[model samples]
Target: MNGILLLGGHSDIGGDLLTRLCAGRPVVLAARRAWTLTEVAERATAAGATEVHTLDFEATDLASHRALVDRAADLTGGLGTAIVAFGILGEQRRAETDEAHAVEIATVDYTAQVSMLTILADTMTRGEIIAFSSIAGWRARRANYVYGSTKAGLDAFCQGLADRLHGTPLRLITARPGFVIGSMTEGMDPAPMSVTPAEVADAVATEITDGKGSTTLWIPRRLRLLAWIMAAVPRPIWRKMPR
Candidate 1:
């Protein structure tokens, strides 16, 4: 089995996906503090992963992305799958007023993903990429548009990348979930049809094993319908929606 590369090893969703998908395969977990993944690496190994390795990954460090991909490929033989899941949701009000904070949010949420995904596409041999997008990007609202905009950009890029990779060895599994109620959203009010990281991971794992094409997975399933409905909503009405 080719090794799996988990780029955002610190995220809850990444960890769940690692445990769920890496059975009988090698896994390379990458994050800012690779040492923090010792527990996750152990769990992955216990869950049937042939071996587990950790590497320091700084998403914002674009200059190092190619090297990171190379290192993972070296350790795993050929990375069978790469999960790009690092992101940050900055305070909406602060982002609205502060240029530096807004740039940070954009860099971390959108720019970093673009940088890493681009490198992975050029480097990976044969496999799939599970990218965790968000339903919030379906239609931006005034309340959290800052974060939503980043996701929207990411969603569009992945959609384009999938089309570009058509008929290729690589498959892009774009997973978009509604407000996730977990450590990441600990203090925020849960949105409608919110999902857990485990749920998202299960959905992703099922989609991959089912041999599905580069289709988007909307968690809770109903979000697919809701996204269409929201798309048709007029901007005036959408702007008035309370967070």
Candidate 2:
């Protein structure tokens, strides 16, 4: 099994996906810290990855994204499947005070994903591109609209790229999980139908195995319908509403 390459291997969703999907196959994990490599490798090995390797992957480092893709291909021997799951949750007030930090979150949430994924889409031999987007992008709330806008951009890009790869064997699975109970949004209020990283991971695994073509997976799945309603809501009505 030419295993899967997990870009944000340290994330809860990424970890769970590896545990569920990499049984009897090789798995490679990548994150911003090399220090985390060994721990991830060990967990993946224990979870049934025949081999596991890690490398440094900083979302802000766009110039190096192509190199990262090349490295994953070299390590995994043609890349069975790849999941790009990097994200950040920062305070909106702080984002106002520190424009750089807000930009960083936005870049990580959207632009970095675009950079790395474009490279992966070109380099992947025969695998799926599974990305974790967010529902916050739908109706950018005042509280976290900064992060939400970023996801909105990424969500649109993923769909367009999926269409671009239509004739090829490559599949794009864009996962949007609502109010996940996890570290990223520790102090954040839970939205309607909040879920766990495990739940998001479950949807991701199914999207890959199902061989569905270019479909976005909403954790709980029904969120797709809700997204329509959310998008339709007028800005004035949405803005006056409380977060």
Candidate 3:
């Protein structure tokens, strides 16, 4: 089997997913600061990875994305799986007044994801590409619309990309998880039906191992019902919903 590449080396969910998928394979972890990948690399090694490597990555550096993928492919021989796991949950309140902050969220969470996914789809002849969407995207709330809007756009992109890859050897597993309670949401109150990084990883990893074709998964599965309910919520009330 070809090796695996994780775009966000330091991401909690990405690290967990790598531990699940890295057995006997060469693994590449790419992050903004390669040094921060040490713990994740060690875990991958303990999990039976034949080799573990790290590369410097910058999600906002669009010009460098293709080069990073090429470098990863060079390290792994050819990538059989790539997890697009880099994103930011920018400060919603600050973003309301700071255009730069809002754009930063847009660039990292949506534009960068699109750039990377397109490159991976075009370059890799087969295997899987994993992308993250969220319940925040299912219906935008006033509290976090800036962040939510990006996820909304990303979810739509993934839907189209999954269809484009239909009947192909390459498959996209778009994971739509709800309220992940992790380092990202350190001080925030946990939302109803909140899940952890491990849970998200497990759901996606199981699908990667056992599923066929490109599929969009509502992590926890029941989130689909919540998503339906979310859609039917009137805008006035939906705008009042908490993040």
Q: Which runs of model 2 end up more than 4 angstroms from their true locations? A: none
- Those runs of model 3 whose alpha carbons end farther than 4 Å from true positions after fitting are 212-214
Worst 10 residues of 2 by lDDT: 206-215
lDDT of each: 0.87, 0.81, 0.91
Tell me the tens digit of each residue's lDDT in model 1 across 192-221.
Answer: 888988999999988888745746888979
Model 3 TM-score is: 0.98
- Model 1 TM-score is 0.96
Best-matching candidate per lDDT: 3
Tens-digit per-residue lDDT, 1-243, candidate 2: 266888887788888888888878877788988576777678788888888878888878899988887787787777878888877876778997899989888888888999988988888757688888888877788877888889889989988988887787776778888889888768878778889988988878876777455377777778778879877889888887655
Question: Any runs in candidate 1 off by more than 4 Å, and if so which?
Answer: none
* Alpha-carbon RMSD to native, per candidate: 1.2, 1.7, 1.0
Error of 2 at 205 (Å): 0.7
lDDT of model 1 at position 72 = 89
Scored by TM-score, the top model is 3
TM-score of candidate 2 against the unseen true structure: 0.93
